[model samples]
Target chain A: MKRELTCIGCPMGCRLTAEFNGTEVTEVTGNGCAVGARYAREELTNPKRMVTALVRVVGMERPLSVKTEAPIEKRLVFDCLAALGAVAVAPPVRIGDVILENVLGTGVNVVATEDIGG
Target chain B: MNMKTKRVDLLIIGGGPAGLAAACAAREAGVTNLLILEREDALGGILRQCIHNGFGLHTFQEELTGPEYAARYIARVQELGIPYECGAMVISLSPERRAVYVSRTEGIVAVEAGAVILAMGCRERPRGALGTPGWRCAGIFTAGTAQKLVNLEGRMPGKRVVILGSGDIGLIMARRMTFSGAKVLACVEIMPYSSGLKRNIVQCLDDYGIPLLFNHTVVDIHGRERLTGVTIAEVDGKKRPIPGTEQEIACDTLLLSVGLIPENELSAMAGVALSPATGGPVVDETLATNVPGIFSCGNVLHVHDLVDFVSAEAARAGEMAARFLSGEKTAGERIPLIAGNGVSALVPEVLSKRPEADVTFMFRPRAVYRNARIAVFRGGKQLAVKRARILAPGEMAEITVKQDAFCESEGELTVSVEEVGA
Candidate 1:
């Protein structure tokens, strides 16, 4: 089986095609860089995506933005958002401060993407 | 009414990327008594609402979210002790660098500055600007507005969405709404190609399996109060909807990411001579506009594809503003540059024969071309030419022409696309 994939590692967005044989990517073509091949393999096998969202700050006018420390399973994006929805923070929150430790049991911690309060 | 005019070494407008970066550079360049006035209650400009990643790769050498990227500069601004006022709206500006602004804290404040940097940024083109026939529906939103609602306010506009443009914002929202459980029907682009970065079209749209319909546009919008559907149709070569080809899609929201126009109302008020091509003030190699002691940069000068470039360009403008404040004038002729056959908008409309630094000239190609070369010629004499794998209007083309090329070209340097081998 063959599948078309676009490399999201960078802005180049090199269009790539992967030839798979029994869950193994045999070959990847039309990639501008090596990241594309790795991306195709991961995409064909177990795809992951980084999720960014905003959580409420206690008594603050604006919400604080956060992102998963690392890419999680693509299917868990909504579940991660739902998990984040129930969480609120008391700022002076600093960047990289863990908002949800291991969100959705995915082993990916959601951290603040900004410094709020302090 | 009597008001005291405050004097400052430099007065920067709009505390966004451009203004923040400019203030940092100016302060570093030894220009004290500078101020940044931002219209929003909080600094960071639109980045506050843009809570996504993939920003700051060029400047920080790492991918960062919008707010994260803004935080780096905001930290620098604070560390430098640069005074800035959020919620201060600049009302008027003079070519002489006089500015008047108003805010709740300080109503109708006047400032006399040695130099001013126009970094007011840009605004999205509304549906009224598109002239699309629709009965002022409720669910319709500009992608940025929807982004603000979703990311900032934690409110979802609708579950079923139909986006009307393929701009980066619309493409991102297609994925964002989907991540929050919205069904993105399709992303319709009037042009044959998308104006957004190729990365966005891939990750934001393709990753989620959303369809992108090229050469199509919404012909009619449905619903009396809240949007229920939009009538989309394939467009002809002239971009007009082809009759009898209308197709309706049922969706609660219609997001328009049609285009963005540089916010130049203040620049016009300042009497800065603007370029009809870039919709920005006509700037020279130093990013100095035709008006003396004033400079333009970032999206307000011309819409940039990346915020990294905005920070870089704003730093340059800041440095130039600092130089202008020093009261040093160079003796040189201001040679003009022309956008030839295949070029659309060229920034730094003019340059000096021997610029102090190598100038990086940027422009938009009129159309899509592959295996092409861009040539810079001065009346039959070709000064510089660079080959490109592919060039499109959606992506801006840039060339770093050395000072020697400027020295070689006596009068005008016309840049245009040509056959690769030619």
Candidate 2:
């Protein structure tokens, strides 16, 4: 199988073609750098994405924004949002405060992105 | 009726990243009295609702979310003891450097300042600006508004969405809406190329498997009361929709991210001349406007692609205001700047030849040029030239010319791009 896509590794945006055989990427071409080859291999198999979302704050008019400590499985984004939708935190929350420990067992903790005063 | 009045050495409008950075810089520059007025209830401006990361890379050398980036400046403003008022909207500004404002606490207040900095940022071009044939309905919203609704209010805009433009904000929101369980049918752009950054296109749309249809636009908006669907069509070179190319998609919301316009009504009220191309104030190298005591920066001066640039520009504007108030600002000959070719909406329309101040000419390219040379000319004579691998209209390009490269004699300076071997 052949997959064509733009490289997110850098601004150069080298259009890449990845030839894979049953989940094993064989060769990557049209890359300006080594980073593109690695990106194609990782994307063809296991893909991850940084998740940024909002969580409800208990008794507050606005929600608190949060992000995954690291990129999680791409397919787990909506699941993470669903997880965040049900959880609420108390006031005096500071940025970098952990909201969810190991969200959906992805091992990526959801951390707050903003500070909210009580 | 008499209103509460006060005087300050420098008064900054809008307490966003621009105003906050400017106030800190001005205070550090030894400006004794300075104040910032923000119409919003908070100090961060639109950054308050921008929860996604990828900001502050240039300014802090770190990737931070919008609020985190704004917090850095807000903290500096506090430590420096710069005064600011929230919900204080400057209603009018006069050429005399007097400003009238209204706030919930200070019903009416007037301020006179030695100098002023206009930091009011830009606003999104609305549906009315697009001239799209659509009924005034409830389901339509500007992309930023939808972003605010999702990020700040934590409320979804709709279950199914159709975004009209490929601006960065719209691209970001497309991913945001998808995370919230909304099905974004398509991202339609009237132009053949996307104005958003390459990184965003890869992560925001491609990662989610969303289709980005270039050279297409919404021809007809369906469902009168609430948005039920929209008919999109491909456009010709002139951007006119071709007949028989219309395809209808069912969606509950239409998000318009067509473009952004600088909020310069107050600048115009103060009699500041605006550049027709940028829809912002015309200023010199120091970001000082035609009016001696007034300066402009950030989006009010010109729409910037990044907030880090806005903060950097605003910091300089603050320093310029400090120089203006110090009674030490030297009078310099004004050299006019022209966008010669392959460039549009070049900023700092004029150059102020301060002995130590080198200026960078920033502009948008008319089209894509690879392996191009940006040339700076003074009276038909080339003064400086810079090389770039690629330049595109989607990205802002710049060339820095040293102060000594220019002659003492005043000459019309022009900035243009030339494709190598063209």
Top candidate (DockQ)? 2
Q: Considering only chain B, what TM-score does candidate 1 achieve?
A: 0.97
Interface C-alpha RMSD per candidate, 1 decimal:
3.0, 1.7
Chain A TM-score, cand. 2: 0.91
Q: Which candidate leads the pack in TM-score?
A: 2
Off by over 4 Å in 1: A7-15, A30-38, A58-62, B330-332
Clashing pairs in 1: none
Model 2 segments more than 4 A misplaced: A9-12, A21-26, A33-35, B353-355, B408-410
DockQ of candidate 2 against the true complex: 0.63
CA lDDT scores, all candidates in order: 0.88, 0.89
Worst 10 residues of 1 chain B by lDDT: B403-412
TM-score of chain A of each: 0.80, 0.91
lDDT of 1 by residue, A19-95 (tens): 98858999999998799999889988887888998788898766788999899998888788899878889989999
Q: Determine which window of 10 residues in candidate 2 chain A has minimal summed lDDT.
A: A5-14
lDDT per residue as tens, model 2, B1-422: 68899899999999988898899899999997999999999899889988998889999998888998998999899898889999999999999999999999989999999999999999999999888887887899999999998888878889999999999999999988987889988999999888898888888888778899999999999887898899999999999999999999999999999999999999999999999988999888888888879999898888888999999999999998999999966457777788989989899888766545678988999987877999998877777899886788878899888887774535778999989963
